[model samples]
Target: MMLSFFDQFMSPTLMGIPLIALAIALPWVLYPTPTTRWLNNRVLTLQSWFINRFTQQLLLPINQGGHKWATIFVSLMIFLLTINILGLLPHTFTPTTQLSLNMGLAVPLWLATVIIGMRNQPTHALGHLLPEGTPTPLIPVLIIIETISLFIRPLALGVRLTANLTAGHLLIQLIATAAFVLAPMMPTVAILTTSILFLLTLLEVAVAMIQAYVFVLLLSLYLQENV
Candidate 1:
């Protein structure tokens, strides 16, 4: 039976057990835990530097109250970066390709920021539903529009990640399939296609890293507004 291209996005199962949970858990195992030592290897040193830089950039605009989120944000950034890069490997399934998983990651974090805003600064939080100096006639319409936009943030976060990753995966698969089919029939064309595929793979690698960062960065922006 011929397999469908879209089947790649489906969560893999082994012997009736879904691997999505394992995929999510596996990234933590891959991370190098810091040991108690003043000195470290080059890899560890580089990892620390990257994390510090990312945290600094992410928190620069937020208030001190939001500074407490540094650990959570850093953890999230690493977790996402790991999974996204891991998914590019052969025989691996990408958990983030699923909208359900993406939304699961997104909605709670997004909701937390909203809840923090409401709990700590109720007036300011609610004020986001309406702008200053609104005309009397447009008040209701503007409030409705802003409210819709506010709630759409989480959905946008999830969909943006899912769409970008899914599109990249599909493109990669399509190119690989074409190259495979053309190899015997047209060796020259197949080589050219494979060359293009190689470049696209590199681009996808960058996309994987970037999409993860963008996801976390947008969350920080939302938290900045609230805090």
Candidate 2:
């Protein structure tokens, strides 16, 4: 009974947005949980040869409080990625295609970098924006320009991800729509369109991972600039 309601509400793109939201929020809920599922905590041997240690640095140390912030960034990316791919399924929606959703992800990451970096050493972390070696006369001008660019990371990341996903989805939708109209007279058109759609799906998979990686990597780099 409950499952049916879940299925009903999940139709069209609107349904997928909430699911993506859930995925995005999951890390927060799971952060305090120390009791791990068997799979997360242990490794089985192929021939009863060895038991490899599982719980190491890869777990993201949400419990430590020190690394909890990194966990959140990684979790957000994973959530966006899961949602982006979900839209590819028939009858599902693409959350990342929406600018608001992508901005929601990017803005927070940008804010986190600023907050964390500044908290480390407000003045020192900020110094990273200016050139390492610069004339005193030009320093003021350079700092102002670089500060503006720093402010733009959220905008840039948001636009790039949103545009790519939105455009890709629209292209695939148009091609698939065209297939129906052209199928009777030119079946090959549908075939070719489908082929293109398949290729784009593969491209989307790469984009999903790459975009997330880029976001996380850049955030880390920003942190490294200060720490």
Best by TM-score: 1
lDDT of each: 0.94, 0.62
Give Cα distance to truth, residue 34, candidate 2, Å: 9.3
Off by over 4 Å in 1: none
TM-score of every prediction relative to native: 0.98, 0.69
Record all residue pairs in model 2 with backbone atoms less than 3 Å apart, i.e. clashing.
Answer: none
lDDT of 1 by residue, 1-227 (tens): 98999999989999999989999999999868886899988888998999999899999999999999999999988988899889999889999999999899899999999999999999999998989999999999999999999999999999999999999999999999999999999999999999999999999999999999999999999999899
After superposition of all CA atoms, the RMSD between model 2 and the true structure is 7.8
List, residue by residue over 52-96, the lDDT tens digit for candidate 2: 121132233323433545546555655665666666677665666
